[model samples]
Target: MTIAAIIVNYGTGKLILDHLIQIREELATVPGSHLYIVDNLSPNGDAALLTEGTTGMDDVTVIGAPRNGGFSYGNNRGFDQAIADGGYDHYYLLNPDAYPRPGCLKALLAFMAEHPKAGLVGSRLEGLDGHIQSSAFRFMSLESEFASAAKLGIFNRLFASKRVARPPQDEAHKTDWVCGASMLLTAEALEKVGLMDEKYFLYFEEVDFQRAIIKAGFEIWYVPSAHAIHLVGQSTDMKDGKQSAGTAPDYWYDSRRYYFEKNHGAAFADKADRAWAWGKRAGGLKSLLKGQGLSSVDRDIAGLEAARKRAAS
Candidate 1:
């Protein structure tokens, strides 16, 4: 089966180039493959460099979007193009900052081939140092949302939460959702589930897409044999430097509320939203009581409340 690899890029030229080089070497063993890079109007001129560098590869195609479409819309444009172009049985959605191991794609594709019911399969993700990262998760319900808001879900166990929670870890195990960093989806699955919801902008888009895929009767699988190293937060850190105020929190919180409201009900969304707001208020109050000063927690709480109100309405 033909496979098309799609990378949605927004700056980080060096990382993207490195990822493509590694992918090219890996693709040599897996023939009838194509690579497409979609650049979302990065200000650093990385798009031009990517377009020029990847032009030499016969299977590579590059498209530059007019503006930043976030992950969903930007990746969707290339995905739709690849699907229309035909000859591809699967589409690999990869982040610019993620680099697949030598046999990662082959392993994932083999798993997909064996499991026809799995529309989406994600690899075990590790950091640069090879430490495990949480790439698969259960669907977020009110209880799960509350636990996370309270930082009591798995933060206590930290990296071992996946093991402690006993999240499916096998050659092929079903999951509610997998991280979008390096997910492979069958073309048929794409046709059935439609494209990623652009309204998500950044966070929670994968969760929303996986929800739709499951609703459409497709299973999401986590393949432990395949692996990829993801430089998580690359885009977010680039957008708002490491030390800057948390400018991207609103997008995340809003998207979370949107997903909860759309899938569950307003009550679930309301409870999660209130919990998040209360968490922020308590944090801010604790800071004041300790003479540490508020760190914009009040403003964050107000924003989350506004988002909750909008979602409820």
Candidate 2:
């Protein structure tokens, strides 16, 4: 089956070009597969650089986006082009900073082939240090919101079922959603769910898209056998693995707000927000009693408030 591999590039020009040969080689495993690189009007002139770098690569095509419309927009551009050129059997979304391990592409393809109901399958993501990242997740919920904000062991245990980040799976299994960094989407699923919601602009687009896939009577799977090394935060400059101040930009909060309001309704989203605010207060009180500072927690609250103001206006 022919596969269309789409890599959305922002300012990661040199990084993506570095992995081009390896990505192309991985695609070669499946005959007739081609690579489409969508440059999202990178401020550093990455579009031109990517174009010149892939000059002689017959299987690679670079699409320069007229404006930088974020991740979903860039991938949709590649998807639209793929549909126009020739509909592909499958569409693979890979981050510009992510490199799939050997056999990753084939493994995902095999899983999809065996499970006709799986609309999307994602590979286990690894860090440069070889640690497994949280690739699978449950959908967001009120319990998860409180548990995450509380950051306490008791809350996590109390709301274990609703925890957003699922533990690393030992084998292929169904999940609510998988990381977008290295997901393979069936053309059938795309035909059913359509392109990702461009309103997201960045984060939560994959979660929204996968949620739609599930609602449309399809399954989402996590295949640990298929692996990819993802340089998390390289594309967005937001380090998620650490607890740091100012790591989350305004768009993150905007996307979070949109995801909740669009999927769960305004009242439910408001309740979720209140649950998180209460949890944060509880967590901060505990930290203060322990002689620890609440700088990070306070910053998070302020950021959310600012985002709310922007949305209201």
Candidate 3:
């Protein structure tokens, strides 16, 4: 089967060049596969670097975006070009820093061929140290919003069923969504669900798209057999580690608000926002009473309130 691998480069040209060999080897497992790199007009000269590095490589194509349109925009640019070129059965969304293991592409393709209902499948992601990361997740809800922010053991246990992060799986299984870093999407699914919502500049776009996929009667799965070493947060330092509440960039809050509102409407988004606010407040009060200080989890009431105002107006 034919395949097209897409790598969206923001400021990670070196990483792409670094892992190009591994990527090529994986793609070789599927004859006639091609690679596309979409640079988001990075200010740090990534576009030129990628263009020069990929020069004379017949299997590789580098497309520069008109503007820094973020992740979804870059991927769509690659997808559009792939469509024009024609004859690709599957489209792989791969991050610049992710290195797929030997036979990774073949494994993902095997599963897709076996399960015709699965519209999207993601590879298990591991750090360089071989530690597994959270790849699959359930959709966000009121209970999940509270449990995620509260970060209390008791609340986590109580809301275990609603928690968004799914434990690492040893085998392939159905899931609500998977990380966009290493996903395999069938052309059929994209044709049905449409391209990703470009409104999300960085985050939550994958979840929103996967939600639409399921809504359109397609399944999503996580395949551990297809492994990739993901250097998480290499492109975006904002997501490197655990972030304190309210400390995220304005775009992040805007994306979060948009995801909720777009998926569940204004009333449901408001309710989820309130639930998160109260949970963060409760966590903050508990920390203060214990004299642990509020260094870790600060309440995001003000930031979220500002997001709400922007959404309303």
Candidate 4:
């Protein structure tokens, strides 16, 4: 099978270069695969340096995008070129911060061969410490959004099916979407669904993309046997440790709003905001009533309100 890997870089320095190196090392024996490092108009000189440094490597190319058009734009550029070049049967969207283990690409390729209907397959992502990251997920919904944000045990148990993050199962299974950190996409599936929606500046593009693919009658799967080490948030710095996220940047909120609005319509997106507000309040009330915690576990109420407002408008 012929495969192409697209890595989007934005001021991530040697991390992107190192990722390219590791990908080359792992895929040395795997044939018909090309690697692209797309520099997304990073402000620093990293773009020039990255382009200069990696171009000499076999089958490696650096693309300098004119604008700093977020992750989707960069990946879309790579995908476009891959399509024009032809002979590529699949496109692997690997994050700059992620490193695949030996045989990772081969495993994904083999799985696609076995499952002809598989639209997208993602590797089981392990952090540097070997703990499983939340790679596979359910698509977002009103209840699941509330359940995740409320962080209430009751809600988690009640909404487990709708929950966005799925724990890696012992066996392979189907899921609504997989994280873009190390995603594999068949050329046919991509051609059917089109490319990643560039509306999302950072987050939720993968969910939106998968929705379109599944709507096109393709299946999304999680393969635990194929693995990659995601140094979580090294590219974006959105994460700090296991469970805690640093204060989210503004684009994150905009992307969240855009995802809901684009997929569910503006009116339903408003309802989602209301649902989230009510969910937070309900969870806090339940916690207070049970004496399990404080009056309110939703400490980021202001942030949520602002985010919802942003989405609503």
TM-scores for all predictions: 0.87, 0.95, 0.95, 0.89
lDDT of 1: 0.77
Q: Highest lDDT: give the candidate number.
A: 2
Per-residue lDDT for 93-188 in model 3, tens only?
998878898888889999999999999999999998999998999998899998787878989999999999899989899999999889999999
lDDT of 4: 0.81
lDDT by residue (15-55, candidate 2, tens digit) is: 99888878988999999999999999999999999999999
TM-score of 4: 0.89
Candidate 3, position 40, lDDT: 94
How many angstroms is residue 125 displaced in model 2 relative to the true structure, after the best TM-score fit?
Answer: 1.2
lDDT of 4 at 26: 71
After superposing candidate 3, which stretches have Cα over 4 Å from the reference?
240-246, 290-299
251: Cα error in model 2, Å: 0.4
RMSD of each: 3.5, 1.7, 1.9, 3.2
Model with the higher TM-score, candidate 1 or 4: 4
* lDDT score for residue 33 of model 3: 92
Q: List the residue pairs that clash in candidate 4.
A: none
lDDT of 4 at 4: 87
